[model samples]
Target: MENILNYIEINELISTSGQPSVEQFKQIADNDFEVVINLALHNASNAIENEDKIVTDLNMAYFHIPVDFENPKASDVKLFLNTLQALGSNKVWVHCALNYRVSAFMYIYHKYVLKTPFDDIDISLFEQWSPDVTWQEIIKISYDEIKNA
Candidate 1:
């Protein structure tokens, strides 16, 4: 099976990537990903039509957050975490356009929720492209909000 775009296996249970094609969704299921969390808009470029139905048909839970790329909010981060929490130990695959949104969210999740050290966090996912001012602010604000909460 072809690898999904920008795929990053975070762990045995958690993976991240850019949008997957209809056929790749089947590969995801074949690999035992029990949940698929989509951060891109439904109409995003290359997004599959009826993705929820596609994933559900594969017997995988689907959660779509549809984050606004230019205006990410702390509430989005909170909801992402809550979704993962609700899913418990299930294997999950999270994705967004070019994996940018997912990378930023995963950064906050690792730093704040998982308490991973700044130097220890795998930053390669984001280092490939510099985050603009808006994303930088959201990243800082997101972790700060999570830290203080």
Candidate 2:
């Protein structure tokens, strides 16, 4: 747990991190995480081969929503929000290659679904790395869609 790459504990219900090794996934399972949601592509840097099987074998539900780093979409954010809502209070561990995607998605989720004010939401993780134009646009679009709804 201590060595999980870029691991950020976002309250009791969720944790976000970079791609985790198989052993880290074991640690996540041992720590009582009920679900593993992967946003990284299968071929992403540091990604575990057969990660779905690895997580499922550890008795944790696994979800993969591959997000294109260069062109994040509002649909992706929507799906992430829907999945998180459906999962309810499950202890979910969400990760992407370097946590960039997860942070952005989590930011949108908090701002919209949780009805948290943007300034009140913690974006430290999202701010760890600067998002380029594509990511910025999607973040704006995602929030706008939710706000307009």
Candidate 3:
């Protein structure tokens, strides 16, 4: 029910809730961007029906990250980052159902891959988006992965 254009920041990357429209897709394609990552598999069935046209019409390379609503995997975060790097996309849109999973992935990407300090991350970013999940566990998981990696 949220607007697709309302994006949240996970460090330098941007994420949104659910699928984008033809106009939103065009905005991404027209921007100085290379790839768009869709992390909305939690709402896959609905997103597919709603945004298939925009996705198919854009004709850009994207990755669908499967996030376990109950228990997400570190490997999923790794895969998401790997996909972004492989695409060489400077501007990427990482999104998920209500932006919860995507936000967690972004936290991992920034904290580990980009070496951004946790203090620099604003908690408001996640709160503003209405992601119906707590990120404490994922944040801890990401920190461990980043520290180890």
Query: Which residues of candidate 3, in runs, are more than 4 Å off?
Result: 1-5, 9-18, 42-46, 50-53, 128-135, 142-149
**Per-model CA lDDT versus the true structure:** 0.85, 0.86, 0.62
By lDDT, the better pick of 2 and 3 is: 2
Q: What pairs collide in candidate 3? A: none
**TM-score: which is higher, 2 or 3?**
2
Give per-model TM-scores: 0.91, 0.91, 0.72
Mark the 10 consecutive residues where model 1 has the least summed lDDT.
140-149
List runs of model 2 lying over 4 Å from the truth. 142-149
How much does candidate 2 score in TM-score? 0.91
lDDT of 3 by residue, 1-149 (tens): 13464465543445454456667677767654446677766355546554544554676556677777667766776777777667553667766655667766767777677787888864555666544444566666645574354
**TM-score of predicted structure 1:** 0.91
For residue 85, what is the lDDT in candidate 1?
Answer: 72
Scored against the true structure, residue 105 in model 3 reaches a CA lDDT of 73
Where does candidate 2 have its weakest 10-residue lDDT segment? 140-149
Candidate 1 clashing pairs, residues 3+ apart or interchain: none
Error of 3 at 136 (Å): 2.4
Better of 1 and 2 by lDDT: 2
